[model samples]
Target: MSLTTEQITWLTKEQISWFTKKQTQTFTKEQISVFTKEQIQALIPQQITYFMETQIPYFNEKQIPWFTTEQIQALTIQQIQTFTKEQIHWLIYLQIQALTPTQISVFTSKQVLAIAEEQIPYFNKKQIKAFTPTQILTFTTKQISAFIEQQIKEFTPTQITYFNEKQIQTFTKTQIQALTKEQIKEFTPTQITYFNEKQIPWFTTEQIQALTIQQIQTFTKEQIHWLIYLQIQALTPTQISVFTSKQVLAIAEEQIPYFNKKQIKAFTPTQILTFTTKQISAFIEQQIKEFTPTQITYFNEKQIQTFTKTQIQALTKEQIKEFTPTQITYFNEKQIPWFTDWQIPYFNEKQIQAFTPTQIESFTEEQIKNSPQLLLRKEEIKSFNSKEINKYNLNNETLSSEIKNNSRKL
Candidate 1:
């Protein structure tokens, strides 16, 4: 007779025990006669959970027939949970269509967690997202945190940069706050710059304040300069008002060397006047030292008149010391013509006597050559010595010929 649906719905422990005994070689024919194929077919729906849970060991030992995909789909949550790794894998592979959302959720949460923890790359994004919220929450804080940390740690520098900017805009405040200091340190300058520019509310005031002086000090010079520049704009009016003159001066002085003259001139009168006399003196000396000779000449005519004789003498000595010997000679030669009014001697006898006769002769020749009127009076002398030597050679040959003629007559 065909079994009723109610009969198929319930598989008792005694029935399972009877089936087990029947499968053994020691069982008698009466024991094996417990259920016909029709009865077993009716029993499948009811016994699926039982088969999945308790019957797997029996199936393995007795080499029982495999369940159809439809029968596997009928398995309960409890049944699916009890599956061994190999059974679950086979079920996933074979019964792919048989899984309901509920079954998939349960199976993934429990089974997939283990698989994912192994970091198998074959898992799809859809499969990863399929994890139930409850399953996700089931993970220990440390586990989830560690997994996130590992992902960040394993991220390439390029990936970290991309995520850092993206996370500032997209991640929840709590999520951003969850990152450890070491993780935060992975952010590149560009990433941090983006974060600061975006003004992420995720960074609590206290958290922002938590950056130590030493930590801020660790930033690159450019970064520090940028931060300080930003702070001038970012700080509230009250905070700005709190800045002491000394602080402002310190920043200005530190950056002044980098500023152009126009930038330097932008300082308020009071700010400009804040430079002590000693500082002003040092700055002047530095500027004077850097000026070229032409610039110095311009400055002497326009600016140096303001200085005392001692200062001018000091500047002159510096200029003289820096001049090349040839430059000094040229300067002296040019200035010597102007010395009569300055009461300087024109050319000392010792200086005049220092010139060699050859140099003097060359100098006199050059002066005459350079004179426009002297060129007309100068005569060119051709050398007659070549013609004389030729005539002498001819005479010697004729004399030698006469001597040979006389010897033959003899």
Candidate 2:
């Protein structure tokens, strides 16, 4: 009774086991002697199946017999299909050593789709890479979509470089659009370059708009500023605007008391005119009544030029009249000659006549030249010839006149 191919194909575990037991008991030395290794190899499937049924226990047990690479390769499609996952894993382990391209293609796709997810990592490199186009296409849209999304951040440079443009473009618009701003942000510089080279538009305006505050903060300053500039109202105008009205007002208010001559010069004429009379009055009152010596020194150095001559004159006269004698002594000792000059114009003829020569001698020539009060009292100091007075004259005169006078003196 010779077995037909179909009968051999359909041989059950019971039939295979019974035959193996009977052969072991009944086959004589002379009968085995007639078979060469090739002849025995042809007969071995029956023996192999018999041992698999009788010797191997349940599939998941660790005690299962290891199949030779050649033996696994010889299994029929039906045998391969019927394998439990553990049995399949065993077969895959053996097959990886010697599988042909077609067999690898067939088995990798089947295992990837059918193997327990936990077993996925056990797949060999060649097996993983051998997945066919058809096998890749068979994945559920979500599964394939997730691979693309994860790859944007997780892929190594070599992996990104290896993906073909068509495979990259296979990601649907919705899939690409689904990435969060955070996910987009995690993309490596290499991945970003790859995306650009492939011309894949991974980020959409809605995705940009969806960025969290922390994500927004993570943007490079240039990137953030450019985005804000392009979308002007995208950020709060008070903090983001180049010329924020609030910031300007705050700086102006804070800086006013300390504004120096150089700083006053830096202000436009418009800024000069913008301060209210009340602010000027407040500053003058604060300086005369409350400012410390350190503050007065700062004001003399930094704030004097911020005032017009008329404003200075008014502030000085107000200070002299309102300040205590001790405060006036302190102010004079600070060498703020401007105050003394301003007070001169307000002196009556009787006040000038009342001044001692020492009091008149204390005045600088700039005080005499620029202050109407000082000019009116100048005759009282007519004999003044101090170096301090002359220096003031040199400084107040025209540059050419000072240069000519200095040359003549030399």
Candidate 3:
């Protein structure tokens, strides 16, 4: 029997579910809009398959979840855009997954944000790329965390820039690792500060290298500690120069040897002073040679003592000259033997005087031969073999003239 539009609105849900496809198709958009929410929800998937594009927008919020996945897939782009935010939010994960990329792209920002967390991974790359930056910002942290790697990677640099700090922190390490270098470079310093220690090390070498100086500066000490040697090696010299003293201290000792000469040289005196003894010991002879004069001067007594003999020998003549008398006195007696003949000449008179008699006696015969300006005290001079002193003419007037010339250079 044919029911009038008025009669249809009054029908029970069970009665509405019994309607044939031909019967449902006969309903007009105006007639559909007047139907009871319960009656609309009762329409079976088979019956709803006959819904005209004109009738699609009539589905109100309360009736939205009752639409089956097959019916949702049938929606055209124009029909999808017609749904209210409340209607969009009511869609189950299955129904959300049914949307074509073209249909998903047409959703308004409000509708896009209304999607549930469980529905987030249903969006394919093209669907994710279609979201505007404004829409991307509307996503809750829960929804952001639910995104799969592919969806996370699909975000354009401009879209990635709009993620709030909370949303940025919610990304899984795998999702973070999936981000393109362009997207990584787009993060602001404030957003960068939100990453936890576990997430920091997941960045690829290229992604780590892509970080801006400001962004690199935002990493907390805990986050800085998590960086791997490979990632540490990727940091540009300019990025290295901007690290705060506290952040510099957080660098892992194992990563110290990975720094290139340029990165090693970029360290400021304040930054150099922050290295632990263990980190100072970790530096290779090659890295030791790259130290700036100011950096060499800043090493604390404890740090100076940690250097290996080979590292000690790697110091340039200018670096050797930069050592304070107090720092020179801190070196181990064993380390005194590592000083080369040329390096010995760079020691100022005060540095020479700072050495203990044992340290002075530890020096090689070749070192004493080249250090014509070295002025040992009576007891310190007694510690060395008289034959070596005589061979080097250590007590001669040439020592006095060499000291005068060295004083002129200073």
Candidate 4:
């Protein structure tokens, strides 16, 4: 016989155990809805497990969120699917944590959006993996904030791509650092733009190296402006090599001092030519010493013309000695006059040959006298005073030796 409403209400736990599953199923939703809250709480897991999914709405709304893990675990997939958005929002952390991955996967996108912030941190990786792309994007900023580094890192790149800008901006520095290189590479340009200043440094060299040029170009002006020297230093030469001139210029000037010789040298000629006077001077002396002659060639004559004597003379004696004749010819006299007396001796005959006669005349008498005789015209030779000619005459061993000895000290 079908269960009557009054009889169903009177059945004690012990008496309910005697009912067949089919007899229990026969209880109408109207009869079940009238049960006291205490009666619903008292139901055994096995009894709760056997309730027709159609009867789920009959359970007290207040009882839904309070279900113990054992009662929750007994819930059929059909019953789990019936969870209201309000029910999903009210599930306490421990209760949410207890939902099987399969049960979590059954949640609709609307239900996923209703998940409470405090409960987000408790989802297992298996449940996280089960989330749909649409469901993942529904996570609120507050929900994302509670995510542990490990929990956030396990999300697939594709799943991560679905995050809204507001959600992405909430990533903690540790969570940003926890991203794998490949996963980091998958960030959309819009998502990448939201990386706050504090989180920018959290990217490792490997993660920085994986960024696509298009993704990097979308970084906000302010975001690019705050990259500390150490962060810029972490970029791969190949990564840094792709920087556009405007993009390169956006790097903070204080950070400019940290560029290593190789990094400075890696800049394209067009990139170098774009430097403002201040930017040009921002290069550390070590970087200047490191500049390849080819890199120096990219500088306009005004830049070359304006270089302080100390800047030119600060180059290593070997680097000065090795300058291509063409590169030496590019230096203006104003720059040339500043060359140290020590640098005078390092210029090879070929480099000296490239100098203009005006340049030839600008050198100290001693420099002209010591130079390769082949480089000087007879007119130029006669231009030197008798004392300079005496020093030039190497066959006059005593005077030449005396000049050479003094040159070593100079």
Q: Assess every candidate by TM-score.
A: 0.24, 0.24, 0.64, 0.76
lDDT of 2 by residue, 13-71 (tens): 45544565455334443333333333334444445443233223233333222444565
How far in Å is the alpha carbon of 70 misplaced in model 4?
Answer: 4.0
Estimate candidate 2's alpha-carbon lDDT, on a 0 to 1 scale: 0.42
Task: Indicate which candidate wins on lDDT.
Answer: 3
lDDT of 3 by residue, 1-410 (tens): 35667876778888888878677767775677667756765766566666766667677665677666666777666667777767776787677777776676678877877787777887777778778767787788888889998888888887877888778888888898889888888988878888887688788898898898888888987888888888888888889999998898888887788899889989987888888899999999999989988788889988988889889989998899889877887888878888877788888877776665557667777777777645344233454455765688654334434444555565
What residue runs in model 3 are displaced by over 4 Å at the alpha carbon? 1-142, 292-294, 300-302, 316-318, 321-334, 340-410
Estimate, for each residue in 1-410, the C-alpha lDDT of model 4 and write its tens digit.
36577876787756655656777687776777656545665667888777777777666566675567778877888888777777776677777778887888778777877777777888888778778877777778887887888787788888878888788888888888888887888898888888887778777777776888777777776777767767677766666677777777787767777787668778888777776666666676777888775676677655666566657776777677666665666677666667766667777756665665556556666555554442343234344457775566533234334434554555
Question: lDDT of each structure?
Answer: 0.39, 0.42, 0.77, 0.71
Off by over 4 Å in 4: 1-10, 17-54, 74-77, 204-206, 209-222, 268-270, 321-330, 356-410
Off by over 4 Å in 2: 1-65, 76-78, 82-86, 89-92, 95-98, 108-111, 137-410
CA displacement after TM-score superposition, residue 394 of candidate 3 (Å): 22
Give candidate 1's whole-model lDDT.
Answer: 0.39
Query: Which numbered prediction scores highest in TM-score against the true structure?
Result: 4
Superposed by TM-score, candidate 2 places the C-alpha of residue 36 at a distance from the truth, in angstroms, of 24
